[model samples]
Target: MIDKIAWLHLVDGRILSTRSRGKDVYYLPGGKREAGETDAQTLVREVREELTVTIELSSIEPAGVFEAQADGKAAGIVVRMTCFTAEYTGTLAASSEIDELAWLGYADRDRVSAVDKLIFDHLHEAGQLS
Candidate 1:
């Protein structure tokens, strides 16, 4: 299993997502947690690296945990995504491995990875997403 962290940045009922360089699908902003890092620390650093915006650590909150088959990977390989919502600083701009940025609603499920689709569904069900 591959474990990851994700930021649930919702704006106007849409969520912020990123497409990494060479990847076809978009994903929730954030990445793998480094060894010895707390989830908040991982989120702050990963969001800064991927979105060029620093997540306000104190504002971070647990959104949900999701898992799915890893896209384009070996059978049985799964990605466990721990998600969060938080305030952040700086304008969002793609950086590092990120190649594209998008604000997605529930209608955009087909555009993201499986675990991200689950997040969208959850947010939509809670009326926090479109």
Candidate 2:
């Protein structure tokens, strides 16, 4: 399993997602944890690197975890995504390898990665995403 972390930011029934350059699918905003880094530390650094925002460490909360076949990988390869919700400071924008940023809703489910699609379904079921 490829372990990863993700930031789940929802606004008005849509979730924040990013598309890396040259990729066709969107993914939640976060990445793998560095050596010896806690989830919070990884989250703060990844969010800052990918979205140019500062995640309010105190506001971090576990959202949910989801796993699925890693996109574009060999069959049986899996990605385990640990998700979180937190308040942030700064305007959201594409940074680093991100080519575009989108606010995706359930209707856009087909545009995200397998793990992210699971997250979308969960949020939709909870009535947090439309």
Candidate 3:
């Protein structure tokens, strides 16, 4: 399995998502951990790298964990995504590696990766997403 950490930023019932350069699908704004990194560390680093924002470490909260077939990978490969919600500082802009930034709602589910679809569903069911 591939392990990843994701930042779940919700605004007006939409979630923050990103699409890396040359990638077709959008994804939640976070990424894989570097060696010896904690989830919080990885989250802060990834969000900063992808979204040009600083995640407030003390504001980090467990959102949920989700698993699904890794998009564009071999059929049997899966991804285990540990997610978090946190307050942040700075403007939310797509960084160099990112091609686009979007605030996606439940209706935009098909635009995201497999695991993000699950996140969208969860948020929608919880009435946190429209």
Candidate 4:
């Protein structure tokens, strides 16, 4: 199983998230890996396209890894999401393929993916949620 990683930003106690067009659930603002792309490369490009920001990769800190059943896939098709927190530049706005951008709190967990729910749980347990 290939694990995908992304850098997430928590600003003013709100977690950054995005939703693709016609998608019901909000997701962490990131994307999948391109062929032969490194984790950092995938993260950098995905965040830029989804959130319109430049992630300071050097400032990235591992947060947690989450696993869940892949959406629209059969059982055992799991998605491994390795999460990170980092400092970044530029004002965040929905861009490229993102249809909506949001800042969600713990109470909004049900609106996100299963893996993201784990992320919120971890953040909440660690007193990181605002």
Candidate 5:
């Protein structure tokens, strides 16, 4: 299966997350890739479109890759989340299809998806989350 990767920014000890317009759960502020787009390109474009901020491509560093059952999809659906922590410019505002923005901690994992739970686990294990 093809993996979906995203660059997630952790700021001030909180991870940046978003919710879709009609969705109740929060998700990491990134999206799926387009054909022919490199991982860096996909990350930059997805983050910009969702958060209305320009992430410095050079500043982004690989955090981890997480996999889990895809949310609201078929049984075999799996997502590969390529995460990153980066410095960005511009105010973080909800743009495009994002309805709200949130800074979530490990305690908020229950409110996220299975894939995001794996991300939280990685962050906690790596001492990035408290």
Candidate 6:
């Protein structure tokens, strides 16, 4: 299984998503945790590297956990994603391997990765997304 963390930046019923260079779909902003790093640490670092924004660790909170067949991988390979919601500093922009960023609503679900779709489902069910 591939493990990763994600930031669920929701505002006005939309979530933040990013597309990597040459990729067709968008993904939540965050990355795999480094050795010995906590979830919040990975989120703060990855968000900064990918979006040029600093996540306020003190405001970080668990959003959800989701798993799905890893996109473009062999069957049975899965990606486990842990998500968080938090306040941030600075502005958001695409950086690092990210080429574009978008604020996605429930109507844009199909444009995201499998695991991100699950996140959308949960958020929509909880009435935090639309």
Best candidate (score: lDDT) = 2
For model 1 the local lDDT of residue 19 reads 92
- If both were scored by TM-score, which would come out higher, candidate 3 or candidate 5? 3
Q: Give the whole-model CA lDDT for all candidates, comma-separated.
A: 0.90, 0.95, 0.94, 0.83, 0.84, 0.93
The residue-by-residue lDDT of candidate 3 on 1-130, one tens digit each, is: 9999999999999988899999999999888999999999999999999989999999999999999999999998999999999999999899999999988899999999999999899999999999
lDDT comparing candidate 1 with the true structure: 0.90
**Per-model TM against the reference:** 0.96, 0.98, 0.98, 0.92, 0.93, 0.97
RMSD of each: 0.9, 0.6, 0.6, 1.4, 1.3, 0.8
Model 4 accuracy (lDDT, Cα): 0.83
After best superposition, candidate 1 residue 18: deviation in angstroms? 0.5
Tens digits of per-residue lDDT for model 1 on 12-98? 999988999999999888889898999999999999998888888789899889999998999899999999899988999999798
Ranking by lDDT: 2, 3, 6, 1, 5, 4
lDDT tens string, model 2, 2-101? 9999999999999999999999999999999999999999999999999999999999999988999999999999999999999999999889689999
Better of 1 and 6 by TM-score: 6
Error of 3 at 121 (Å): 0.6
Output the TM-score of candidate 5. Answer: 0.93
Candidate 3: deviation at residue 8, Å? 0.3
lDDT value for model 3: 0.94
| lDDT tens readout by residue for model 6, 1-130 | 9999999999999999999999999999998999999999999999999999999978999988899999999999999999998999998988969999999999999999998988899999999899
TM-score winner, 3 or 4 = 3
